[model samples]
Target: MKRIVVLLAFALTSCSYFEKQVPNEQELLQKELKAINWNQVDEYPSIAECEKLTDATQRKQCFFEFLSSTIQQKLDTDTLSVLYPELDTIEVKITVNPDATLVFEPQFPQDSTAYDKKKIDSILRVRLTDLPKINPAIKRGIPVKTQFILPVIIRGE
Candidate 1:
């Protein structure tokens, strides 16, 4: 009985050790995209062609096309008109805290007359584990700070 119990424990431990390390879908997609160089253009692939891409790099590009479509659908004529009342552009700086916490601040428009001050602090929060899978700088419980500048252009309707 003692030998049988020990054998069972060893088997379970060994199985845990051999658990395969598989990359998540999103991480895989990011890797594939990073591996390739893509040229940016005003026009993008059609929905049907995008859905057909199987290669990691191609699929990533396709996904971007899908995202743009979704955004267009969400922003109707009225919302777009208000958000972009004139031919104006603004730049925003997003800062992420080093301690694995999220921190976002928007740089107000210089004129303060083009767009509203409405901005969300965190559009999406990725989990700690997820970060490691994408960016090498990210780790479990490690503090990191990052800054990003985004220019939003609004064309008059």
Candidate 2:
């Protein structure tokens, strides 16, 4: 009975030696965060037409090309080029919000005094308001906002 009691006690104590310590919630979360790459997204933003593409590079290219063409077409209908004949190309900063809203801001050169910036901005706002539905970019399966600068050519004709 004494030997059995000693063996049982030794067995119970030895079990702890093989047991591994589990990391706490905070530690686990920190580890996961470190593993993620914040600079690059898993998927770029897309429209319904570009969504049919399976390749990442192809989809991104399609989205940018479509956006540039759409912006050019919309602005062509307006008097932007006629008002600012000196400006042949304008670099517009496009922001794609996580909620799928778009914001367009025209970037002008430091010495650009020939054009009225406020008037140009207002025209852009009106022309760009009725764009097709956009799907926001995805990072780690979560929707994220993205911004890119697109140079749009102004048709002088």
Candidate 3:
């Protein structure tokens, strides 16, 4: 009986001694990346006007300043006669393509603006066409595309 009990214990212990596979270097790298925030980039894309700044924070600020100024400067407020007094805010999704072209996507509340989508697209395209090529953002030393949602206020005179 003691011999039978010892053999059963050995069999149970041996059956439980399975090995776990260790991940390879590439698999380990991918697993580490899954823990990171992809939204944050090492370097932001810049325009010609923001190229002078050397510090990372300053460069990012300058890029945003230049972008906002460009949008505000190019908007033809005189052509925007369909804005409601209370709801004058229009959200513009600005995407800087890898090749440096600008795309303006306007989002307005249904009751906010009287203008149709086609009219708004036309209005924004004209202003966005003048945007210069942008240096793409960098992630781990590789260039990546970036975008921003800008709120634009249009007031009627």
Index of the highest-lDDT prediction:
2
lDDT of 2: 0.93
Clashing pairs in 3: none
The collision pairs in model 1 are 98-143, 98-144
Question: Weakest 10 consecutive residues, lDDT, candidate 2?
Answer: 79-88
lDDT of 2 at 132: 92
lDDT per residue for candidate 3 within 94-121, as digits (tens), equals: 7866666667899767785456778777
lDDT of 1 by residue, 18-87 (tens): 8998989999999988865443322222235554666646754664454334333333332434645552
Instruction: Identify the runs in model 3 with alpha carbons over 4 angstroms from their true place.
Output: 1-23, 81-87, 110-113
Candidates by lDDT, descending order: 2, 3, 1
Model 1 Cα shift for residue 1 (angstroms)? 38
Highest TM-score scorer:
2
Root-mean-square deviation of every model: 15.0, 2.6, 9.1
**What clash count does candidate 2 reach?**
0
**TM-score: model 2 vs. ground truth:** 0.87
* Per-model lDDT: 0.45, 0.93, 0.76
